[model samples]
Target: MDDLSKMGIDAARLPGWLRFVVVIVIVALAAGASLAAYRWYARPVTLSIAVGSLDGDAPRIVSALASRLAVNNAPVRLKLVETGGPIESAAAFSSGKTDLAVVRGDVGDLSQAQAIVVLTEAVALLVAPPGSAISDIAGL
Candidate 1:
């Protein structure tokens, strides 16, 4: 054909190496395109977690939780959703929009969701101001 002649690729005269190169290039391009498509579709899924109170140390605690979760190599991505209060956080967890949430042990009934892990035990410390006679448990 006139088009073939213009390209100077005399189909019959083209060496085997040239043909091989062309095939390799086409295969490489196809592989690259497939990889790009896979990456786009297999993007990580974000799992929202309701965190009680965005103020004060709450945000820091949430950040630490997220980091720990990441280190565990969980498949889903973690997103901290601040509910501004512990009550709201508990509600969010019960409602199902949030996958996980943090709340005080006595906050509410948690029979609906099973505990995956107990991170730590929360301790209550009683502090006395100034020169108080409170030295031990019986110093009231």
Candidate 2:
């Protein structure tokens, strides 16, 4: 048989099974590369977050998440908007100025707000300073 190399086909040197495997591998790599390129150019879903200065952790935490997503080529991203406080943040959200907000339930018109994460634990504790006159809610 004439050497296929003479025809400038290097893959023809491999055995039939090897040739099949090589083709499969090449196809898989091409598919993966195409997917990666598509993801790299894809527009991510951008979400605006309203965070308060008082709760500084909100911006820091969300920024970290957004960085991670960007590094991973994730489909979601957050844009942080710093507000004066929780109530102001909630107002921004309610007024359609932001898509998300870090807010306290007791501080705003939260009728339209949906809970995302509870940064602070809400627990009723009964305790006082060591030299206080009372030690419970009744002391108030």
Best model number under lDDT? 2
* Model 2: CA > 4 A from native: 1-42, 120-140
Per-candidate RMSD, Å: 7.6, 9.3
Candidate 1 structure lDDT = 0.79
Find the 10 residues in a row with the least total lDDT in model 2: 1-10
Candidate 2's residue-wise lDDT over 1-140, tens digit each? 35767777776466899888988999999999999999778879989998886747777877788789889977888887888878889889889999998777777777887787777777986768789988667778
Q: TM-score of every model?
A: 0.53, 0.56
- Per-residue lDDT over 1-140 for candidate 1, one digit per residue giving the tens place of the 0 to 100 score: 67788988678788999999999999999999999999888777778877776454776777787788788766667798988777788888888868887776556555677776566867989999889888988886
Alpha-carbon deviation at 71 in model 1, angstroms: 9.4
